[model samples]
Target: MTVDSSIMISFSTASKEYDNQTALRDITFMVEKGEMVFITGPSGSGKTTLLKLIYSAERPDSGHISVAGWDINNLKESTIPLLRRHIGVVFQDFRLLANRNIFDNVAMALRIRGAAEREIKTKVYESLKSVGLRHKSDSYPRNLSGGEQQRVVIARATVAEPNLLLADEPTGNLDADTAEGVMRIFKNINAKGTTIMIATHNKELYRNTGKKVIRLDSGNLVDVGKG
Candidate 1:
């Protein structure tokens, strides 16, 4: 297939296996820049594995995967960090450092990239404000409610303005109202031209978002539709 400049993510015959179990099978798809697509299916349908491939946490077993023009399948170990700088991943469980306050947690990404202290402070504050968590910037993760913690994770993921945003069940732990609020934040980020691919089982959230949906089942990609 000819690679399109507009395509930010592409997978060709990609598969992942653990011993005898195959998590993904011959998966192929393209995610264009600035598009929002949902990966939806029952549990264990390879949604998370697909996201992991994009994020370079795992390599495909048999095929090629590319993200933001970087060939993840053949990426050098030293370059993985550089590749991840262009992608933001939000996990089902908010991966916040328990001891760190919200500002420090959100600033960690920039810090790792060697951003100056003044820049980190400004960017971290702006990120927290975007999530409406500016007041809680000094609070530890343990002190925040589940919804609040998730917002902090979101803030951290987007603070650097990544080119691609991968959210795996981002709203899974929230109540309906809180989930809606989080969805709105995702929408706002997408509006700013960031590519968004969300893995979720929440049918209502998918329907309400009105974005293209990519369904998967038992390691097979189903179809794109308005789920």
Candidate 2:
């Protein structure tokens, strides 16, 4: 397959196996820079596995994977950290530190990248504002509601303005209203040109979004079309 210059992620017939179980099978697709894509499937359908490959949590047993123009299929362990700096991740459960305040949690990403204290403060506040959580900067994660904590997680992930954001069931645990609110934050971030790929079971979130949809079934690509 031809690689497009604007492609931010490309999987060329990649396959991955966990022991005797196959997680993905010859998955070939490309995600353009700044595009928002959704992966949907039933339980154990490889949605999480695909996202793991892009972020280097797992490697394919065959074929190739390229992310941000880097040949990550064979990427060195030493360079994994370098690649992750440009990527952000959110999970079904909020992974914030209970001991840290909201501001500190959001600032952790920048601090890990060796950002200056003044700069980290500025960027963290801006990210919090974008997620509509600036008022809770001093509150701990345990003190906020589930939706509020998830928003804090989003703020933490985007504090550095990553090129790609991968979310796995980000709103899976929230109510309908809260889930819609979280998805709106994702749409707003995508509007700013950050590429986003979400693996979710909530079909309602993608119904009217007009985003690209990728369906996986039994480790195979069953469908690829726009919503």
Candidate 3:
């Protein structure tokens, strides 16, 4: 199939398998630029695997996959970092550095990209302000509440202004109110034109959002439509 610039991600009959089990099977889908999409299912339904594929952490066993018009199936190792610059990932676990304060943690991405210190500081604060956490920049991750820690993760992920964001159960650890607050931050990010895809087994995360939801079951595409 021809690559379309507007399609931020595309899986043309892609499939992935682990030794004894299939994680995804002949899945075909597309996510357009600036859209927020959800991938939901029960436990072990390939939600995480799907996100890994997009992030290039894992590769599909068959068929094709592309992100922002780059053919993932044919991507070179040297080019992976370049592709990743356009994507931000929020892991299920808070992968914060124990020794670093919030400001340092949020500055890590920019530092790795060789951004100037002044530029890093500016972008990092803007990101933290966007997530309502600029006041907590001096605090350590261990001292913050779970919701606050998650907000820090969001700030760090968005500091580089990626074109796309992938979150794996972003609110899995929070109470309902905190989850709603985090969801609000995500919506604001999407409103600013970043394409987002969130993977969750929690139906409450997707229900009533009215965006598109892709459901998977035992490695099969069960449904693809509005949440």
Candidate 4:
């Protein structure tokens, strides 16, 4: 198969199984750089598994997968952290530190990257500001609303400006309006050139948005088109 320079994520005949059940089968798709794509399916249709593969949390049992130009099908365990440096992931559960303030939570990303304290301050503030949460930098996760906590998570994920952002049911715990607010933040980030892929079962999130939708059913690719 021809590799396109603009492709940011590629899955070629990838298959994965756990125990006796298949999570994905012969999956082949590509997400272009700077594009926003959605993966949709039912409760256990492998939506989350697909995102895990891209995040390097799970490896394919067969075929090949690539992200940001790196071949990850056989990616070494020691280099997984290096691969993750170029990718940011948001989960359904807001994994914030209750003991740490919002600022510290976001700073953790830069800290892990060995960024200087001065640089961390500047970038964390910028990221929080981008998500419209700079004012809550001093607040703890429990003190914030559900939507606010999710925004803090977004701030944390994008603090290092990763080239690719992957989200798994990011808005699952929010109301309709709050979910849209989070999505708008994603759109703004993608406008600046980061590739994004969101896995969700909520059709309301992608309806009328005109973004590419890849649907899965029983680990099979069932549909691919504009949402």
The candidate that achieves the highest lDDT relative to the unseen native structure: 4
lDDT of 3: 0.92
**lDDT tens digits by residue: candidate 4, 29-83:** 9999999999999989999899889989999999899998888877899989999
- Write candidate 2's Cα lDDT for 186-207 as tens digits: 9999999999999987899899
Q: Candidate 2 — worst ten consecutive residues by lDDT sum?
A: 1-10
Candidate 4: clashing pairs of residues: none
CA shift of 122, model 2, Å:
0.8
Q: Each candidate's lDDT (Cα)?
A: 0.91, 0.91, 0.92, 0.92
Worst 10-residue lDDT window for candidate 1 reads: 203-212
RMSD in order of candidates: 1.1, 1.3, 1.0, 1.2
Model 2 scores a C-alpha lDDT of: 0.91
Put down candidate 1 lDDT per residue, 117-178, tens digits, no spaces.
99999999999999999999989999999999989999999999999999999899899999
Prediction 4 TM-score vs. true? 0.97
lDDT of residue 72 for candidate 1: 86
Clashing pairs in 1: none
- TM-score of model 2 relative to the true fold? 0.96
Using TM-score as the yardstick, the better of models 1 and 4 is 1
By summed lDDT, the worst window of 10 consecutive residues in model 4 runs over: 1-10
